[model samples]
Target: MSSSIPPSVKPGGHTPHDHDDAEHLKALGYASEFKRDMSAWANFSLGFTYLSPVVGVYTLFAYALATGGPPMIWSFLLVGLGQFTVALVFSEVVAQFPVAGGVYPWARRLWGRRYAWMTGWVYLVALLVTIASVVYGAGPYIASTLGFEANVNTTIMCALGLLALATVINLLGTKVLAVAAMVGFTAEIVGALAVGVWLLITHREHSLGVLFDSFGTGTGGGYLWVFAAAALIGVYQYYGFEACGDVAEEVPDPGRLIPKAMRRTIYIGGAAATFVCLALVLSVSDIPAVISGEDPDPVSTVLNDAFGATGAKVVLGIVLLSFLSCAMSLQAAASRLAYSYGRDGMIIGSALLRRFSPTRRVPPYALILAAVVPAAIVIGSKISTDAITKIISFAALGIYIGFQMVVVAALRARLKGWVPSGKYTLGRWGLPVNVAALIYGIVAIVNMAWPRTPDAPWYDNWIVALSGLVVIGAGLVYMIVHPLHDRSSGPYADAVPENRTKA
Candidate 1:
């Protein structure tokens, strides 16, 4: 049942041509209920917007510079390569499975319901936290661009407001979301190239050699530890490309298209991020001032220095566009995850969570639930900055954990004689590629879980690792208490009876 070519797929294996997606869904025990309106470009746009380089690079640029100096920019190349291996593994799995819920469904089909349940549980909560983190990150940028005070209260309000807007767009259905994603994608690409070129040409404060310098201030093995910490910027930015696969059910010719979209997501997102980060570093008029907290708003300060206050506001406005697109993509992916879990009766109140909006053809309740958690987190941010930061910091770690589970499962299946099929196949290269992916994933997880601040309290220092363990443990308890064996067992148990293959 578990292999690159699952028995649920057509007997002959992957066809070079577009096979009947509906028939494939039927073979897997599902119906063509979703509106498969997403084009291949729109699909790619989701991943690109989710991995919004502008949002991630800009938000983390100052932190990276302060922690590891100009050399930190190179971590994008390092981490991007590592993450690309992970993306390769994901692209193969998604091509074969091409179902909703992404990693969760793929895990169930490749492993089993138990593994899938835990994967779904952990991944779902992780995605919720991701939404909170992204929205909160957007708040300050949006506030500054709009002339707000940019205080905690204002940031929280702005985050909540943005969250609501994203939720509403998701409720309108994938078409609206897709259009918004395309717009966001265009803005991000233009913004990255324009700003990077402008900074590099007109305002180059540092030479290219500066990127190789070891400039970090910490009481440890020096720049090595600092570089490792800064690598998380790449980790956080490169993910969410799987968002394309998460909503595969809504995309046309998913078997042929989703895999391509996933790869393109990495290529485009990575290049854009690398360019912008390099530009930001080169444009820093005063690196020491930024590190010392004198120039608190590094991104804005750099922009203003390069192109005055008016120009800075215009560029910040583009940044806000990227944030809006990011939130939309995050919520859209999250809702699909919720819907997929609900569709399989994998969560509480399966009836409501799985229901599609009569007119919109989207999961309204699921979208609502997705919006609610992040909003609550935003409210909590108002009460305690430290608490909110701890929770949000888990975003990258949580996502990487979910990703590694899929990679590990893929590796296990490959070792058991799984050969990847579908339009995109690694063929003889599959084994080594998969092995490399597993290694990178394991290393990345450990790196993320490693205690960065030894002097901080245990909870503060080990929150990322602990949050992952606690969530997985809680999932185990939930499964034991609720028990999903009856609904999830066997090849056809969770499939719609009408869509079941006639033996």
Candidate 2:
């Protein structure tokens, strides 16, 4: 699990932990610029918070239930399994290249700079839009709980406010971000458990078998298609586990710790989300009515039915906290991505974006850029309220696109005789799992991005697919016009650690 330190940077006066971390980083061709303030728990908390069950489930719950009925709940387990496969590949990659840029860095090391740039570009956009989506999702819940009119202006303002709060937390440095994430994690767990238990005990209205019942309302290529669309909720929820890898530089012994943090984030987050979804499904009073639009907002309706306005409001408040925490983690992850790209002089204004504040040991400019793009997205979403759904879909699709690029890269690397190193390894099962992960990523991307709304305009139906193409196309154009010298092959080539031959 430990990387060999290059003789030049070997520990003399530095503590063993700091020396190990510093040398590990130096061998990877980066300075220990920021404070490695996050512990393993904080690392896991950031990932868990980024994959916030409250935000993901509550935001998309009604859509899934309406689109695919009760059976859609099973999509959580299915997507969780698929994503776990991807997580396995990512864990192995991160163990060796435990740097700031998550998918981007992994892709670059495995493939090259052009591939990494695109992965970073798609992921950066996804993370930014995700911040906007999380904040916008929080608005109505916040408004309803606080008795404010949940209008466009109010929602936009609320989103902006939350984005601002997240920005401030990121600006405060790793310790504060870690603390906020931990608090958010604790709150979400407690709140999910409290509401889930209450609902199951007092309001259970359906059999456990209901989750398998499709209710015979299949459309748009029958049950599987509807199920695929419903899987968006699960797909979105299962991601952000890589946020642990994104902030790997901030974690001590990242090669060993980050992989564990990533897996734990998925396991714990997936379980909590499933429990909540199950309780909500079993608590539904009338599934037919919910699917028929009689209860357009089944999640809120169920909460209000189980516990009066006051109780619902309390739960909504916890959900709002979850939303904010999710935004905070998204911004932090995105900023690290920016910093990573900028560090190698890959992006424009690399000097400023890569600069770490001496006092706070944070990338202030990168944080600002992260907040700015999402704030712009929020502003745009407000202009067309209907755009919120499409934007969220597109964002999730972008993330998957970036993820599969890494999966594809891993497969290519494996075929080229690459071997994984560090504490974690799939061993003989690696090829099958990698191939399965690759297949799942491709299938999921097509399923999620395929136009489900045939009646809608072409652009509306194809927003996810179109957005992904545009992002990738734009990145390509930019790269062609302003090509980057591959850092990994240049003077700054990462030193090959003596013990790191397995990679």
Candidate 3:
């Protein structure tokens, strides 16, 4: 009854029902065994594409359109640069502890079980909350999909529906998830290009001057740096690529696969998204009108304004589909990350979490649990979409926190002369690179904290208030109550499962 054995054993050992839930992924010809199928490009694509549609197009850019105005394109670049710093740090840590568990495993191995457990809780809960937020955000797009009014109620229902589909897909295993990732990645690339094309075609007379014109400080009464910093919020747009790294073990040749995926995801996604932002900025004829619209959807605003009614509708359909694919990828990622953390005794429900869909080599119970996280947000967004937004945005802070932990580990390792000293390094004074990355993470968290322009139709701060406390508090409680608390510090091994949670 080793909880860590093959991760296929049931409670009593008489062989349980086959995990039929995971077969869809395998049927798509993804590697069945954990650590067998995924590549770095695949993972990177998953994270890259996941963020563009869901956060960039649907969420962050919309925030800019509603708050910062056309200048949001600059914000996109800033955030991208900031997160790029974090990605470098990941390159260091992922090389050493190149396991499937990601930061949770890396933290556990580098520090110890207690801190690792805490990190695991933070990552697990944060991802689910993120999935929730995406669902909350994507619901409207879904409503728009079927030509529904996309009101709060309709959006919530659509989001929940997406969550259901994603849950089923993830439970089917990493292969289907990978396939979806690939499909989603393609969709995002095409979607962004399509939007850009529509913008150019319609706004033939659009001004190229706005691209270089700095707008924020001109009116916000700040220096270029201040406005540039403020604009960086749009930069947070290009995350969620690291989700592929979470399922590292599920992919074949994980070490090589994850890094490749991670790098490609950043480069391609960064380039593609940056192109979209530039296109959006240059292609629009009336910046103020789109920004000030009653429903200021950035992508739609740009496309519709630049093109005509027809062009706008076409772009809208693409954005809608992109969000659906995004929802699917995010849910699958959250589920796998939860399963990985739980199966490794880094979270609660170790016993239940260790059970994989025998037929599909996936974690069904974990996916089921993950579905609820987003579904709840979808429901909450019905009452207060702002709550959903704030909570999820704050959860992003936790993600950066977990990542920084790994970054710190990498620094300490370098100080102690660790192997694999960054074949993928930032090179020529790496310390500055690390420092820049660290500084970016710290700064971005502060910016995301400001409520200068985030107020939305759903009037409430419950998402930020409750989510921050609940998720972080849950992690702390588990760390305090579990036998793996710091006081129990001792040598451990990959095979050991001490202080496993009953839940």
Candidate 4:
């Protein structure tokens, strides 16, 4: 991978490679608007920052431990293997399509405009909600670092501030975004490694045998059901790899480089997440209390105990940076998806959303939309304390559903005899991998969306599945009334060379 660098294209000057990339875009029925500036390392950094193991592990450690005991840590490996298959399928699609929007363009070129519209709609909502969730998760760390009280009001305020900050960085264009991602990736890796090693070396409270012991957790249905509920820790950590392909127009040699970046994001991010989880599990001072729900925040307890107040504060600072970087990367991906929708005239306010700032080489209005929608969602936290949790629950489910839609579309195209013709092809492995991805995606979506909180109100229990259905149903109604799919100008499945003239 090349080193992270600034935008390579200069005013009135373009490299031959840049011209070739633009020609490829033209062949796909779109003129290149974004500057091809992000290098291979920058692309990987973007996805890595979005995956952000520090952010994911820190956010959900307490909940997972409380619900499923130490054994829940294995979910990382299970979900990692499943998601790797999905990444392989996506890498091949992106290698062939290499469009601005990740799943939307892939689905559109594989199926039709209608399928792409709904898939994009669901994925866009998920990204916006995820941004809100990440920023809100950072609230406690921000409050602790700044010596402020961590309350609902404080969380909302901090989330809004973080949203605004991320929006500004995104508005500056892809170069600044890439640089920030690189910095975040570096901080996350170093901080995670240092913290994990320190905990394992100086704060080993339990032996490795604890991972096999559940500490009498789980419900009447047994540990299997509870383990599925706790799998969110791993399910949430494996995505954001697709963000590498979301900015396809900004990267050179995307057909080859983006696939490598996506695979790297999954392999490296999964390993980091597993290591961090293992370290924390081994360092927990009171596993029984955590599983029994007596101690609500094991993460804070472990950190404060291992590293004194001063050291914990330093680690909190790193956690805050991870959240900011994750939120920023989500915003970048969301804006590009929105821009792709508008560019095809498949959404409301197409002109405004598709408006590109040539100077910055970004979709400014789209960036604002991404920030504004998530900010609105953050404000909704005032309605109920569980609002953020519900949003997060749906965020993971919605992402998996959107992903499966693309997987199914790809499988359908393959059945119709369409073969991937990009530089990066799975070759004979394509069919089996695509099949495995679809099956895993389906099972994961069901596991994530299933109602498990029987003690809570019905709405809270069903929030994950309900929220996804609501979004998809709303999109269906909009598609019927506005007929945006019919008005779309983007190329469809029939336009591909494999479909029209044979591979």
Candidate lDDT scores, in order, read 0.82, 0.85, 0.61, 0.89
Ranking by lDDT: 4, 2, 1, 3
- Per-residue lDDT tens digits for candidate 4, residues 1-503, read 78543476445556546777877889889997898878898899899889999999988899898888889999999999999999999999998888998999999999888989999999999998889888988887888899989998998898899889999999998899989989999999999999999999999998999999988886577889888878878987899899999999999989999999999999999999999999999999998898878898999999999999999999999888898899999999999999999999998899999999989999999999999988888888899767667766778888888899999998999888878888799999999999999989988988887888789999988888898888999999999899977977768875244666742
Clashes, model 4: 0
Q: For candidate 2, lDDT tens digit of each residue in 169-212?
A: 99999999999999999999999999999999999999898988
Q: Per-residue CA lDDT of candidate 1, range 1-503, in tens? A: 66576554445644332258877777777874677768889999999989999999988888888877788877788888888888888888888777887888887766667777787788888889888988888898789878899899999999998898888888888788888888889988998899899999999988988888655455477667888887777877788688999888888789778888988988889999999999988888888787777877798888988989989888988888888898899888888888888888876877888898878889888899899998998899878998988887678777887888888888877766666676677888887888898888888888889997889999888999888888888888888888864474335212222323332
TM-score of each: 0.92, 0.93, 0.81, 0.95
Clashing pairs in 2: none
- The whole-model C-alpha lDDT of candidate 2 against the native structure comes to 0.85
Instruction: Candidate 4: give the clashing pairs.
Output: none
lDDT (C-alpha) at residue 211 in model 3: 54
Model 4: lDDT equals 0.89
Q: Which residue runs does candidate 1 get wrong by more than 4 Å?
A: 1-19, 216-220, 489-503
Per-residue error (Å), model 4, residue 4: 20
Runs off by more than 4 Å, candidate 4 = 1-16, 495-503
Per-residue CA lDDT of model 3 for 1-503, tens digit only, reads: 55453454456432222232134223322223462444445676677766763346545555454445555566666677777777766765554344555777666655556667667677767777777776666666666657789788887777787778877767666677777777777777887877667656666444666655544434555544445544644545656657666775565444445666776667777777767766766655556655557556556655556667776566666676566666676666666666656555554576676567777777777778888766876687757765666667666667766776666655555455444442345555556667787778666665544444346433342344445567778777766677533443223222112312211
Note the residue pairs that clash in candidate 1: none
Model 1 residue 89 CA deviation (Å) reads 1.2
- On the 0 to 100 scale, the lDDT of residue 470 in model 1 is 83
